[model samples]
Target: MTRHQTSNNRAVLRTAAVPARKTLGGGGAAFLAALLLLSCSNPSGPKRNEAKIQGVVYRNDTRTPVPGATIVLERPVSVATAGEGGSYSMAFTADTTYITNVIATMPGFRSDTEQVVVVPQKTSTVDLYLRADTSSPVTPSQSGDAANIYLVDFTPEFISVSGTGANDVAKLTFQVRDAHGTPVDSAHGVTVAFSITNGPSRGEYIFPSSAPTDPRTGKVTVSLNAGTKSGVVQILATAQVGTKMIGSEPVRMTIFGGLPDQAHFSIAPQMYNFPGLDWLNRTDQIMVLVGDKYSNPVQPRTAVYFETAGGVVDASGYTDAAGLAGVTLRSGNPIGNDPVYGPGFAYLKARTVGENGATVKDSILILFSGFPTEMTLSPSSFNLPVGDQAGEVFTYRIADRFGHPMAEGAAVNVTSDGAPVVLSGDVNLEFPDTQSSSWTTFHFKVNRKESDPGAKSGNVAINIKVTGQNGNRSISLTGYVAY
Candidate 1:
């Protein structure tokens, strides 16, 4: 009898043919010959014991098939080539179950190895994933290369300074890649380090400053915590490969929103006193300035509310970058009066929400004065001798209804009907101080010239007019110029 066997694609033959026995009868010999012929002619043969290993080869980064990859079996030293679809199959005759390593490799990719077990007459499946070799061999004298390192993604790019919940922390992810943009992991001897390049002093911190790249994804993630200060933060990631260092572009994050504090909150008026009595066109500017507990300006667009005891004020305004907000107070009816400051005085208040969710307020005194209700002229008439070049002085006083001086910038004009007399004095009035009387006074010098026509008429009328915020007053006095 002749037997044939195959293992690992190699053939082996064994022959077991018996010589015809002389002692046997001719019939027996014929029967034996028939049996031999029958055995040789039979189509059915002994079943061969075989085991197979088959699977697909894929790229680690993209999970895509890697065609033309070479597959090798270590124990029996058998080799197979992957087909167009990255599929490979290896079959071998096995008498017993055994363990072996299967390695997959391709050009420009790192080899992958997986341990597999083969059972007699049983098929085992094993898949392999390969990574791209993005780095070149480096010498000990060379510096580290970080060209393949990248800061891929970051979360919460804008956060509040030391805020709670989602606004308190940020997440950053970095990847190491090869020249072909394939992800390379720690298996390729790549590591990453993180740092804060530009940020507020002691205002931010990161966790796991240094770490090895992930073997599967070639990525590393870290957390950044915001501090008490508000400003911009910049982070950098560096890849360390052998002796070379590769750095990625820096990433920027912002920390904003500082709440207002009472110590730094204030209200100011452009002027303490304005002509806001009954003059609807008159207006005053009121401003509010706010700052955080750290003495930094509050965030822009913060809301501020305004209220006044008298007149009309803008209801609301928003702060600017400088933490300043302004509103206009227009003159109207219902003038406010203060017992101490007298008439035209009102309380103006500004308020905002603080960090603690409480209302922060500031108040200031604003005085709105109207036209003067009383006016007095000393002597009521001017007496000048003819050819008197040395001018005679006269005084006039004006006051509001509450015995307070009219608002500043009141105008006074004096003229003579018969002749133009030379007059010298201030044409505008200034607000009176607390130490001074409530009346605002003006003085003028009246001169009679020898060539004056008023001296020839012997009787001249002195005309005086005063203009106030909401009204005007006129006075006429008869003056005699003796000849």
Candidate 2:
């Protein structure tokens, strides 16, 4: 009876407070009320800070640190490079990840690249192993020490072969013998691939030398039965390194197709060859047409592959459509007439193609005999600044009696005031005036001796000589100076 009376009294109190009370709804109301109680009792905790990351890079093969190697943190953000102990340290926030690259670079050692990742507050370790570098120099790139490996029925030096068309197959064979020319059972280790450039594509067209090894005679077949460029090309065996340079000897073969089309172009007799036209003097408007058997007009962007073991080509063109497509030919015209190249045996090749992109004309072959062309500097003179060394500016052009820009990268012999300098230098430079596909003009920064503070100015002469395969140079020059 007392408990019932007390509950009735509480109900009376609730009814009395209803006029002054409001309601709070949902779990949010419960949370807010709890928060209020807590605020009256306890305080909130402190905030957390961002995380930090760090690490080191080492040599994988030797288990040693590879110092001086280039390292990159290639992720959320990048940090790089290890100091002297082959050790590196870097920092990052907790939530981010990073990629690290390590490159190996040491002489007589091969190079390599590696990757890694790092998370916040965590340290990552990445390392690398670099092998020694071993490759031949087709260009002026740095190469390692090498012993010669001579093969039979193959040219170790660059050679050329002709192809039927874009898809034509070209073949050549090399013997896998010892340095003494004795065939060895060595074909098993050969890995051959072709470096295809300047063709329809612009990278390696590899043909692995991994052919079936002969158990008996130890003879390996070095053949390029596929991926031969239609024009003149320098094909060589590219060897990969890990062990000795001795296995699977590298061989070179120059493959070419078609005969050179006999071509002739005209220039106003005075532009270059006027009464005093010195050799290598460029003409203004090379106004001659190329002679090919095709009834169709010469394709504007055809593969007019022009090259010279002798000199460079200048294709500074007037037309915007084709990037200056120039070639340097052997300067002299010792070339005689042949069925392939009617008169100019300058080894020029011209081909016609159908809509299907197939060779429409037979590859023409040009055979030029006799001493090659001469390269001479025009005005053969100059007055250079006393303090500031000025370059030698000259006008040079290539023609086959008729005129045209020679192929590209021609060998030109240049002399200072009559003294010999570089044998082969500079190719077709951009011409000066009218935007015609005619003659090319260029300024050669006349290399000068460090100007002596004592002498104010001096008179000198320069000669521009054209070179040939045999190292012979055709010389011409002008008044030179050093200020």
Candidate 3:
């Protein structure tokens, strides 16, 4: 006997062996025969190879399971819904390894996609995290309605004091965000308030200090106007969500460049004196630094007028951000002929409008040195007495064209033609001070040397040379060395 059975989409074949009574008909009465039976069932084909992908969907920020989420697979196109536990699984008939994108999406949440590799006969686990969509309003989390208040943009962080210019006002913008970093707008009942936490007393004021966040951007903007005082101002933005208050990091701004004051207005030059006389096309820098009554630098671009009694000076200049203005003082006509060094003096004055609308002025003196024009040797002739150490002192006076002493650091070199002279004392002119002389002097000692036969007794000639920026002069005087 043979039997065939089918169950659970599978087929089974059965075979049976039995003894038969009529196998040999002629020996009916005596013999028993054996029979064999074979049964064949219809082919059911080979089992299919498959790969699976499974994972759980979660909230991006909270990492909590999100049920009722749809998981979609590309490249064959299959979809599955997350179960109560936020778990989803999809199967694919695959012969080898392959890659596919799995996307998890839910209402009121942003969609997230992850690429997964599916190996034949194996399952791949992929986790997807989704964030709350900010395009549309979302319910606030139970933990805290507002996560943080952010300072989005603060323009013109530096502003001048009141009535300075167009830059005296600053704009500040803020945004309120939830725990998921999604901007929360008025729909969530979020409002932002601003205050000056730390700064100079009443140094700044804000307009529209409190406002509700915009529905689209969740942002609030305000304007800050500077006061008369100057200092650092820190503004804080706070958001009110339910009974909780969220504050952002402090935003810092600067109020600088106040009005100038008389006490703090002054002028200085890069060099007190330059070769302004006798040397054409010479220039020096004249700088003026102005400050407010509080010792802060005055407002930038403040005009300062310059005037000079002698020589040429820049007509005017504008102060820089540091309240410093500079002008060029050039050597030109109208030279001062003071007695001392005939070096001309250029009296420079810088004036500007002060805080009280009065003229604040400061002055400085700069000297333009003249060229050496005169030279004299006292006792035109001298004699060194006969001795191994015999010496004579000679004095030389040098002066400028106007009888004033030569400029400081003027070089004077002396040499002897017929006598051995050991020269000492200042070879360079001394810098002039309040009490200066009309002429600069140099001294030299003429000695009769025993070492040299020619130095014993003979007519000696002295040579002098004076070098200056304007010109050079050389003079010779005759003397005698006697034995």
289-337, model 1: which lDDT tens digit per residue?
A: 9877766667677899999887889999888777899999888866877
The model with the greater TM-score, 1 or 2, is 1
Clashes of each: 11, 70, 1
lDDT of 2 by residue, 92-148 (tens): 443444443333333333444444444445444433444322331111111122222
lDDT, candidate 2, residue 66?
Answer: 46
lDDT (Cα, 0-100) at 163 in candidate 2 = 35
Using Cα atoms with residue i matched to residue i, what is each candidate's TM-score against the true structure?
Answer: 0.53, 0.22, 0.55
Query: What alpha-carbon RMSD in Å does predicted model 3 have with respect to the real structure?
Result: 21.4
Kindly report which residue stretches of model 1 are placed more than 4 angstroms away from their true locations once superposed. 1-192, 199-257, 279-283, 328-334, 339-343, 355-359, 371-376, 386-391, 398-422, 428-439, 448-483
Ten-residue region with minimum lDDT total, candidate 1: 136-145
Models, CA RMSD each: 22.6, 31.4, 21.4
lDDT of each: 0.68, 0.35, 0.68
lDDT of 3 by residue, 1-483 (tens): 222221221222222211221112344213211111110122322655776777777766545467777776664456678886677888867665666566676666766766666666876677766665444233333222567878878787467777643367889888777785656644564767889888777557988889887765567898888887777888888876677788989989887767778899989887564555777667888999988776777877889999987688899999887889999998878786545334466578999887558889999877676666668887788876766474667788776655455554556787778656555554434344211454466677766666666555678888888875545788888987776
